[model samples]
Target: MRYDIPIWKKSNLTLDEAAAYTGVGVCKLREMSNDEDCEFVLWIGSKRLLKRKKLDEYIEDMYSI
Candidate 1:
């Protein structure tokens, strides 16, 4: 058996993956995730994960960030 996670099928994404998926810079994604007001960040220990669907909703709602 084999399992593969295509980007669109993921519920969470690493900064690198998020950058590739959204065309956002890794530094910028990190910066945004660090914000106290950010709505798309998920923390697992010290690792920050971006919520894929929420991120899509955020990007869709944003004119600029």
Candidate 2:
């Protein structure tokens, strides 16, 4: 018998979550969030929340070489 698993959807993510997704530590993520060169990251109030699509795009852009 096969079991069906439910898919989870994430709209917004905390700094920690974004860090894990990018394989970077929270401290580094914070630094990237502040860096003007990193356009993929966005700040929501005091918290840094990364859009899922944007993060993916950033990763692809980084690995294009």
Candidate 3:
């Protein structure tokens, strides 16, 4: 069966989904994910995903992007 999970409920998010959820923009999200100090980036081969909970925490802790 296929799951119909929402972006907010997901464990990880694509750049587009994250952009929509966080209002951070896809290019910016990609840039942020490329940072070595970033804690929420997950790589599956050439694809990058963001851990949603960690992203939320990161954003919450940050004063600015």
lDDT of each: 0.94, 0.65, 0.94
Query: Which pairs of residues collide in model 2?
Result: none
Cα lDDT tens digits, model 1, 1-65, are 98788999999999999999999999999988898788999999999999999999998999997
Model 2's alpha-carbon lDDT is 0.65
Clashing pairs in 3: none
The per-residue C-alpha lDDT of model 2 at residue 2 equals 79
Q: How good is model 3 by TM-score? A: 0.92
TM-score of 1: 0.90
Instruction: Compose the digit string of candidate 3's lDDT tens values, residues 1-65.
Output: 99999998999999999999999999989989998888999999998999999999999999999
RMSD (Å) per prediction? 1.6, 6.5, 1.0
Off by over 4 Å in 2: 1-8, 36-38, 63-65
Best by TM-score: 3
Task: Give, for candidate 2, the lowest lDDT window spanning 10 residues.
Answer: 3-12
> How far is 64's C-alpha from truth in model 3 (Å)?
0.9
Q: Rank the candidates by TM-score, best first.
A: 3, 1, 2
